[model samples]
Target: MKQPLADAPASDAGRLQVPTAVLPLAFGVLGLVVAGAALALWVIPAVPRLTIIGDELVGLSYIVAGTIAWLRRPSNRIGPAITGAGITWFIGDFVFVPNAVITALAYALMWLPNLFAAFILLSYPTGRFFSPAARALFLTAVAVSAAQYAVRLFVLDATGDYGCTCRNPFAVLPNVALYDVVMLVTRIVVVLITLVTLVLIVQRWRHASPAGRRQLAPVLFAGAVGLAAFAADITAYNLTKASADAGALGVASVTGTLLVLARTAVPLGLLFGLVRTRLDRALVAQLIVQLGQAPSPERVDEVLAATLHDQTLRVIYWSPAARAYLDGRGRLVEPSAGEGRAIRLVERDGSPLAAIDHDAVLTDDPELLTSVTAALALAVDRGRLETMVRAQAEDSRSFPTGRVTLLYSDIEGSTALLDRLGPRYADLLAEQRRILRGITREHGGREIDSRADEFFAVFPMGSTPLAAAVAIQRRLRDHEWPEGATVKVRIGLHTGEPEIGDEGYVGMDVHFVARLGSAGHGGQILVSQAARDANAGELDHDDLPADFPPPRLAK
Candidate 1:
């Protein structure tokens, strides 16, 4: 059996239960203290008032929003990424310290939070990034940042850059010209990275389905704006002839204030996207109302597609009797979802109930997926019952009452033939059944029941059963059997008013006919006196023996 995606945690019945919010809460408190220290020690004393306030707000926003997201859905890694970004953002403020070693170290690693930003955007919705180009680009950014840090620490002096009055203790051989050249190249590369990031976000949006687009929209909008603003602000500040004035050092200029404001949108957008699952929960509420009681499978499918905003969705019901998943029309269907599709299994009482095939976007929001699936449980079970009923009705044979002729037939030496043919027995059995059914249908006979190599059919009245029996025997003799094996069938005919039951003909007449068929030799037809009397002289036209053996009924 193919295992369900949701069954992962439930597999270990004895696993210890862990509270989801414990770590987030603990880490959130710790992050608050760190952010406070950063603001009090470095930001407030050194930077302009507006920049100090912006730093506090932006850091707090990241931590609070990330904590909430983590509490809401612990499975998504995006939450942790956001929270860690906040902590690292504060940590990077060590660049404002007056100590040479600490400030140099901070300057070397200040791009940590920005790297986190890139990761959060590229891997939006799902925390795990999948695209090869995206992964490569992120790694490239890391490599470039590491190189820049090495160059800044050993090859260049930054005694006055970003208003840092402290001397660079790690500058081994300061070269002003080389520093300018390196800075220029680094700026160009940063611009290129920004452009690539924008292109990637646009590509993702364009390729996404409608449902996927909804999930990506808010985050993409905020991320794109933030990247553009950062690129523009950096270019304008660096390329222009603005002097590195000591008085203006660590001050929040108008452009710096705008940049910080733009940065604030990133966390807000992430928080908005995370909380947006409430809208899906609302849809689930409506879904429950729309479902009501005893809704059809098609209705369940429609409501799910509408609620989830995934139009290409289908529900396949599980039939316990059939031991398979079946469609609304009771046709067998595989649980597999084809290209660009995904399957979510639905279970009742820990047993497989049904599966939903829909667009892959639904997997991004685990909370919504779980909610919608839980809402659909009762409806899917009802649909399963309906599908089973349909299958039973289709398999059942309609029986005729009153006086009727019943014919029973079976392959002679079936066990021995099966042993001889091995796998080829299936082909022989299929051909035999085909011939028997065709002859019975041609002579106005309806099949009452059939199991394996044995067949039981009912005819309306005189001569039809005999005619069908003769035709069956003749076809078996003339047709070439499979596996180069000779095949023969034994037939018995009886006429009586056999009682009809829910499962077709019952009572002694039915039993007698079955037993009589078993007693005959291959290629031979046995008839009872009752049938012979009812259809007198029918054997003459059938080309059967005039002196037929008495019906040998064996119990």
Candidate 2:
């Protein structure tokens, strides 16, 4: 069995219970606090008006969205990555630092948020990269970004460079031509990688399943829009710088604002996808309702199949007595995971009750399965009990006994019927056994032994056994059987003090009961004199034929 994601106790509504919602809650609080601090930076006289406001909004949006995602799915790494990007975006504003060392450090780390955004786009839905190609692209993006920053820091001094007034304290070898060439090449490489990443995202979306598509749609939409806006922002800024014209500057400003607004959709889309991709609570509710009314194993399977939307789903119970898995019919079943199918073990109180075999897609949302199983724990436990009962019946056992009456019965023409019916006879036989067991239990008798089409039961001294025999006769006579097959049973009753051990009644009385049952014709019930005496006044003498013969002892 797979362990739950969180160790917190289960809730009444089956949400992911946590020890406290504090940790992620604190992350959200701190993110907002940092965003507020950045807002203060926006009001500082040294920062550019458009740059400060745009940075603040973009950073705040990512922080808030990241906070929501992290709180919703704390185990996922994507949330923290996004939140880190937002924090770094805010920190990058330290390019306004008066201290030369701090300004240089800030410039080196300023472009990191872009690299983070690239990783986020390449690894949507699942927080991890699924293919080597994706990993390579992510690594390339990081490498190119680092190279660009390094060249800008050492070869191109920021003092009186690129319209920056801050001195480049970390500049070692000033080579303006080399710096521009390296920066241009890195930018071109980064653009190509971004295009490749976009293509990969499209391919993944095309190959995704219906459920997968639902999860990817929002994030993909947001990412594409953000990328487009980013490209436009870069184009406009370059055009404005090259032209030195008022109209170009106006276009750059408009594009920059649009870029900030467009980037907001990326985090919003991720948050939307996370919130939307949840197991339908209604399905779990319906399951709880169905289970409340004593559903059979088949009904349980149907409910689960509908709930999980996997029609091929199967519920196999673990029989502790048999030490194996069994189907609903109590027949042995071997469950293995393969071929786009998987099995999840359902447990209660740390003991295995059953296994749910379902589509492998469900593995993406294991918490849903865990919650559903917790809710269905009672039904699963009941199924375990039913499985044990059915297994015991199929593999009948003997028990210790004292003074009691024994009844042995067999279907008269079972062998011939089986020959005629072939495999269909199994169903008929199962029904017959069911009827017999029901009648036995009704008459206060215990079925101690059963094999093939035969049953051996013990009852207390009373007319109950006689009544059960007659009831079985009438039921078999009137019941509608398959293929117009007639069902007839021969029962033998004997009263004696039999010494029953682990293997059941062991004395001559048991053999005597078998012999008496074998001698009787179809639909006949033969009783020993001892049974007749024991039931004396309770036995309806009128029901017995007047010409019935006296009991004979077995040699």
Candidate 3:
């Protein structure tokens, strides 16, 4: 007993236990019909035993399937309509035992309506071949062919002319040529269409997933049996005379039962496809890798290259020293085509690193970006801490004083330089310190680091503040600069600052010195009024010059 391949609806599985119970019911019907039809076909002239019962049984299938559609797929209008029509017509096939041509014509008319019903069944995509249209067309063709039989039945009844012992009611229809041609053409068309339908069914069957095919298997098998039975019945009908149509009715009945099995396969297969979640793990892992925390450069690169090698993405890093993106060799690099996603990798010490290319979507994932951003932040914080510790040790130093002329030096573009240098900006300030040491020593003074980018110095007690100021300007003007950069220095001086002791942190001497040096400018110097008073002997004014490093700076 082969089962009717049909599946229950999603809601039905949850709401009611009886929804899919029809499958087993259909299987039971199949077993009974198959067994009963088998027996009926063994005996000749036993058409009644097969036709009437088999037609009703096949029609019952439409009812069950239609009822399922009505309950489970209310949105699908055609399925229920076709099912109902099939039910009504198949019921007519049983009740009206019409012997007259007119009655036979009416009987055939009843099946035509079911063809429309079968057409409606096509809309439901369950594993079964729910094509009500084929049935509708088949019924239409059946009716047209029956017209010839009806005419013969009428002629026999009216004239008592049931010609020949082997009387075919259809044999007497006028110039049989037209009818034969029409019938032949219709069969040809139908056969061609069926072939095409078979191809579609096979393709669909093949493409379905393993689970889908399995669930669809019974339905496909049943459908194949039904189609095979139908083909057999037709072949038998064509190969023999109508009076010799001995096994035709029985064969037709068998085909009908098999059809119930075939069409039901669709719904069954669909149900199975839904229940089995295939490749779900693979999908999840792919999504996690795409949206998870980015690993190191190598890992990130692999992900980028592997994930979206087909897409365009390119990233650029900022270079402050060169004022552009720098490559591995510290040279400017250009973008290339087919770059999937671009990510800039910046060197921790303000050097520009390589650009990363990957799939843009991976970069777009907010989670991935946030994780990378957080990691960058931590790296930057650590670098800054290191900078502060080194700056403290390297910038601070000892100095002596006895009315020594105090000088404070600061880089003119320090803030902008820091921003441009990024994490490595702290280290560049060391160069500024070295430059300040040379500048003060040339002017006969000792210098100490006051801060990261600021230097403190003092001339011999009698040296002019103006002289110290001139020295800074001259040093900056003469100092060698890296290509594309100008090293600008600004100094402030106060002559009265005189604190000399081992306590190096802070003092009134350092305080006043700070106030004077705090002033900012590039290649511009400020000398306090006290520094000018101390420089009177060295200046040209009879009483005292108002400038230190008097004439040289004034010039």
Q: When superposed on Cα atoms, how far off is each prediction in RMSD?
A: 12.3, 13.3, 22.8
- lDDT tens string, model 2, 1-555? 333344455564256445325666676678777777667765556666566677777887788778777776677767877887787776666666556776677666677788778878877655788578999999998889889789867876764312245667778988878887887677667667767877888898787655556656887878877777666665654555431111235776676567667777888787675555453655687788887654655777888877766677888766553456666655567778866577787777777677888776667666667766776677766543542374366336544356688899998888899897888787667656655765776678777767888888888765388888877776676555656678788899998889856556788999888999877767789989988877655545454434534543455
Per-candidate TM-scores read 0.65, 0.61, 0.32
Candidate 3: C-alpha RMSD to true structure equals: 22.8
Score residue 105 of candidate 2 by CA lDDT: 73
Off by over 4 Å in 2: 1-30, 46-51, 71-74, 96-104, 159-164, 231-255, 277-283, 293-314, 319-323, 326-333, 339-341, 359-361, 383-555
lDDT of each: 0.74, 0.70, 0.46
Q: Among these predicted structures, which one has the highest TM-score? A: 1
Give per-residue CA lDDT, model 1, range 435-492, as digits (tens): 5755776678776767788888888774377877887776667555544566778888
Preferred candidate (TM-score higher): 1 or 2: 1
- Model 3 — TM-score against the truth? 0.32
TM-score of 1: 0.65
Return whichever of 2 and 3 wins on lDDT.
2
Model 3, C-alpha of 275: deviation from truth (Å): 11
Over 4 Å off in model 3, which ranges?
A: 1-47, 88-96, 99-102, 110-122, 126-175, 208-221, 241-555
Q: Model 3, 41-157: lDDT tens per residue? A: 334342345545544455554555555544444444534553554345443332123244433444324334324423432323331233455445445545554653444333322
